[model samples]
Target: MTTLLTPDELEAALRTIGAERYHNLHPFHKALHGGRLTRGQIQAWALNRYYYQASIPAKDATLLARLPTPELRREWRRRLIDHDGTEPGTGGVARWLKLTEGLGLDTAYVQSLDGLLPGTRFAVDAYVHFVRDKSVLEAIASSLTELFSPTIISERVSGMLRNYSFITEETLAYFAPRLTQAPQDSAFALAYVKEHARTVEQQQAVINALKFKCGVLWSMLDELDYAYVAPGHIPPGSFRPQDDR
Candidate 1:
């Protein structure tokens, strides 16, 4: 059987999970931000990550649909607009495409999502389902990964700019908004979890939810590393390195 923890203890446990399991610690991330990746590796990173970026609005909408009150729904609706945009050529998804375009990936094929690794789709989809099926508290808790996102974003933007001549600030602008948005969203999520998780069981569930989310993010990178880096197994029909082309 599991025991409930006090709110402060719960917070500490969540931090511990971030310290140990966050994608920032993954070797693929280290290679990415450390400038060790080839151009093909960078492309693989962006292509896989598009799956994660594209799914955010759908998952946010699912949570919004589940909210009981108009106020919460209104607050959550901003996330959808932020990702999907008020119009074309705007918002997070479009900005992400800019990153892909800058990387020389064809916008049509990228948007088609026909180029994604199988594991990338599976992991990102699992995150959306987690948000939909869990308690509201746990759903909100899962987003706390954003609490840890700003640092990784910083590392990615700075590292790419310094190491890769092909990368430009405009290409990386997708992260600029995320730097602000993630902290704002995470603050709300963290506070929500801290306040609503009154019992130990609820608090533990929130902690577990964050851990599960970290695994989701981490697993995507693992898949990328395995398929793009180690043996460089380019899955059938997926993007292949120029040398392989």
Candidate 2:
């Protein structure tokens, strides 16, 4: 039988997963932050990523439905507001649209998701389904990826500002609030997992959940890299770069 990990040990193990498998290590991110991608390629990324951004609230709502406590429900409800806002034309989704618009993507076309890659769609939808169908422990554990977000957001904001003239601070505003929000969310999630995952199996499941979430993120970038970068094989009907568009 697997031994149960101490809470500190489990936390360390989770951080180790982030160190090794997070999408920050993906070549697509390296290309993006390094400014190696052309404007059209960046546009393709923004357009496709908008689908993931738009789906976040729905994912949280599904998880929210599964929470057992009014306190937990109230805590999780903040995520809905963070993404969807109390009103339309605000919140993270709206900020993401600003990014897409700044990238010269038509907002209608972006929202239509008409140009989104099949892989991006599949990966993101899988996340929503995972949260809906999995154990609440696993679902919350999956969000532990947020533990690493602040660092990546800082890198991305600074790199994009320095490297891409087309990228203004306003275009990158979506990440600014996330710098604070992600840490708060992740801390709660990490504490919840460490507190609740009392058995060996549950601890292992939590670790696997983080791995699965990382795979979801990494695979999105893999598709982007395969389709958008070298030997480019963008699938039919997806957004084509400007040269091809």
Candidate 3:
């Protein structure tokens, strides 16, 4: 913690965090991607995930307002446009709605977030608040999860298509753009963190920020696994899969 890491060492450390802590390693992810989940379970996953997806613009906006330079703000601005789009039926959030629609959930119900798991709400809200409250370097570092996303997404789209009768290429169209978008976004974040995280303390902060982001993502899945997989404790007032009902 005292030695300043060279950029390579820091990048390696960040990648190590992704390898160790990312949610793609979760059992629920394994089951979902391996096609072991029932339709109802998938429904629960998609429904719960909608809140996180829809919140990306707001999260980006919080950081955007805080970015100190025109360049940084402009770069961050693209993320908002990517998620929110210039019009309805465009961008990542709308595409995510396509995913839920394909899964047969009512879009209104998904957007209402009334059935959102408390853990999901808390975890995602913490992420937004992290962006809003953290140092700019830490805020950007928190988005380092994007570095690990393409792999999980590939597994998900292919796995869901192969296993689920209802899942179609169009259902997961949201991820297709992300295959490119995530890398670009993460590349910028990684470079920015490496360039600016100069002190040992700052480097550690970046590492912790990524760990926190990973924890947020991991915790969301934990909520899903608990409600849908393990002791199957569907918390009160949360969405109930027909299986659980």
Q: What's the TM-score of each model vs. the native?
A: 0.95, 0.98, 0.98
lDDT of 2 by residue, 1-245 (tens): 28989999999999999999999999999999998888888898888889899999999999999999998999899999999987878899999999999888889999999899999999999999999999999999999999999998999999989998899999998999999999999999999999999999999999999999999999999998999887789999999877432
Give the 10-residue window scoring lowest on summed lDDT in candidate 2.
Answer: 236-245
RMSD for each model, in Å, please?
1.7, 1.3, 1.3
Lowest-lDDT window of 10 residues in candidate 3? 236-245
The lDDT for every candidate, in the order shown, is 0.87, 0.93, 0.93
State residue 23's C-alpha deviation in candidate 1, in Å.
0.2
Error of 3 at 17 (Å): 0.5
lDDT by residue (tens digit), candidate 1, 27-77: 999998888888888988898899899899999999998988887787788
- Give the per-residue lDDT of model 3 (tens digit) for 124-215: 99999999998999999999999999999999989889988888999998999999999999999999999999999999999999999999
User: Measured by TM-score, how close is model 3 to the native structure?
Assistant: 0.98
Model 3 scores what on Cα lDDT? 0.93
The residue-level lDDT of candidate 2 at 63 comes to 98
Model 3 vs truth, CA RMSD: 1.3
Q: Which pairs clash in the backbone of model 1?
A: 4-200
